[model samples]
Target: MTQTHPSPAADTGPGQWNPRLWGLLLVLAGNMLIDALEVSVAVVALPSIATDLSLPLTDVQWVMTGFAVGFGALLLFGARMVSLLGRRRVYLAALLGFAAASVLSAFAQEPGLLIATRLVKGFCAALTAPTGLAIISTAFPQGRARSRAVSVYTLFGAGGFTAGLLLSGWLTEHTWRLALAFPAPIVLLLFALGLRLIPNENSTTAGTPPTGHRSYDIAGALTFTLALLTLVYGITALPEHGLGHPLAAGPLAAAVLLLGLFTLIERTVSHPLVSLRPLRSGALVRSALGAACLNGSYLGMLFVLTYQMQTVAGWSPLKTALALVPAAAPPAIAALASGRLVARFGAPRLIAAGAACAFTGYLLQLRPSWPLDYPGRLLPTLLLVGAGFVLSFAALNMQATSQLPPAERGAGSGLYQTAVQLAAVVAVALVAALLAGAEHAAGPAAATSAGRPALTLVAVLGGLGLLTALTALARPTTPTPSVPRT
Candidate 1:
């Protein structure tokens, strides 16, 4: 086994534009754009897609969830494909698949087909997403160079989400198809340029091809997928169904059973897709949970504010996204400065401060109204949330990814990305559940009265995120698998 330690600034060698790190940066930024497009572009288009397909809210939700499901499920296999095939082969394959999926999604005649294609695209994205980071991880050593690379990689990924908001609202107004297809051409261009930018190191088999490849655990995969699928679906359905209703109970129970079985199989499997031991590292586990918590607040806040700006306040999509400018831009600024701050203050102190600021920001947003003032209300919360997300995003990735050995990078990264997506899935559903519950209790206009509760939720989640940072503050010198423990 190749003992991989964090060497961010390794000799990336010649033949690959040794001096042209800019090219690699473009490739990475493009990768972020691809992923960001998946989420952000769809938000503004949701109302449109829902209308065109005549799909109910439940069914329409799947359009995005399908992609997330594919993305999360295939992450484990994605890295291995890179390990088995080669970096370039896997990446190009993923890009081509994503492109095809985009075109198909663009031209779909019905919702099911469109969603199916999106799912396929998500799978391709899963394969490609980590490869981009792995390429950087290998290209740069673990010192300042790697640190900068990690910072840039994460910063772009964070900023890309915000950029998606601007582009989504604008593009969907004209044609939703273009929103999907727009990036495909750009990705192809990057694919062509990326061929020379990075070395073709065969990551799959370091030496000779390893024989007797273990068969994938389809049972575990099915059960785990079904479990999460049912649980999330059930939660999302609760707004319509009463809590005691069997409609929610049946699927939720099935999810529990299936997920339980998944654990049992993973423990006994030859090559487990998810390793249980990583959760043993208290530091990593806490950090992973913290990442999830921060996102629960961040994503939920985004959804609420977006809706408030448009549906309640009667702002246009463009105007709604424009309202996000204050919140969106600061993360870019923070992204640039966070690396230095992390170096000086470390992840712990920064995480705490960020969380505190985020808490204060959300509290300020407790009573949002139609006017949606940017300077007084919007700007402060946006600044706080942006700062918190920037700090937490980089720190979480570093804590999760840095603790692993070289061989485990693929699986570890897969787990990390999966958790992030799962966080989004849960945030929307869970936060909405809470909001609806509170709204039901407080009459129709709950967002106005329950701003404090919503803000409180964000603050509490931020506090949990802070706790995760404190746990990881010591930076333990061991492999911490980035997945849930049994």
Candidate 2:
């Protein structure tokens, strides 16, 4: 069947270069930045949150995990909501909800209460995030404009992470709540602007349903969240209290059981939150797996690098964050360049090459010595890792997004986002567990001596990820006409 592509909407532009187009980009990117900011801002604020609530480091981490699991839970529903409520309405509603949640996070007197507020914040993120990319797809059809819009959209994400680090450092220095409260003001400001700037159209991605009564699968949504929360809580609790401990096994098994049930339910339910079919797309499957390793190693590196710099090399927190600047660059540049790169070199090869560069950087950075090795060992590795990341992230995103049909974009993207988030969460726990155990056995001087093993674990993870990227190399340069999204 020759699937007829939707023509550019009635409002499509050419050389006109309307500010609204740029504004549209901001709306999408801004939504993503909120998610990114929630993570980074809270990092700097952790000490403050802990101190205020008199909680342990383990408990405080939930302030983040709560939000993350929440976001991932509802992310699939995000696409559906856009169809039902209209993208613009959903987007605005998300902003308002996010703003409200931020206030709650800022003012919460109890740790559990803060975690609950974070859950709400996470749901708002899920509602808001998918539409950002979906909006870009419509505002700029998949060509030069999309290439640029994707670049801008992705840049906001990378840039937001960087900004979050910097802002977190500064804001937390004065008041942790300020960091949480900051985006509230920004979101409100953007809310006013978005109201004026966002296109009046509901179908951000063309050719879907033109405003109908889209059903909300409350049962599917609730069950999926329960399963994920159970799993994440279980997995996360393991490092602190070993796998055999009740704190770990109980939740973990329940999560496994619940999630298995969730899968069974998805197969039977209409409008499932996530359909399993996307898992069969060889390109998407590999892309997602490869990206997972990339993210895991990336976060792990950030962890190791921060520890080496601050505890061993005498670098300040600000300086440690600044050191990560290079790792964040390539995605910005490549996202803009993706259209040309894909048009010429093809997506699979580009993904392969990107993974190779990242892998190379990891190998070089893995020194047998320690933090005191400083510029001789650390600087070069950090720079290479940064360079490798810059070259890859955007192209990887373009490749993945390009392979999926438009209607499935939301669910597919939510899956991608979930994978990325899960990788980061898992990396933090597993890497920390390994390093902490190693450090304990090695003693205080281990920081300067045996950190190499931690680095190698990260490198090995990256290498495995690189191998997955090779799968793309075998994929045909052209894709079959996509089915409506997963």
Clashes of 1: 12
Candidate 2, 106-184: lDDT as tens digits: 8888877788888888888877766777666776755666766766676677667667778876776677788787888
Off-target runs (Cα >4 Å) in candidate 2 are 1-13, 18-26, 42-57, 108-110, 137-151, 202-213, 311-314, 364-368, 401-411, 436-445, 449-456, 474-486
Candidate 1 ranges beyond 4 A from true positions? 1-25, 54-59, 138-155, 192-199, 202-212, 368-371, 401-413, 432-460, 467-486
| Candidate 2 backbone collisions, by pair | 330-390, 408-485
RMSD of each: 6.1, 5.7
Candidate with maximal TM-score: 2
Please provide, for model 1 over 1-486, each residue's C-alpha lDDT reduced to its tens digit, 9 standing for 90 to 100.
853222212345432323546677778667866776687776656656766777644556666676777777666756555666667667877777777788888888798788788778877887777777777766654455655666677667767767877887788778778776777787788777766565556432124223467456767766766676787777766766866788987777878888789889889988777875555545456556767777667766776665556544567677766777666667666776655555555565666666667777777777545466778888778887887776656556656655556765545656667787777666665555555555556853544663445456666766776666665556644432332111
TM-score of 1: 0.82
TM-scores of the models, in the order given: 0.82, 0.83
* Cα lDDT, all candidates: 0.66, 0.68
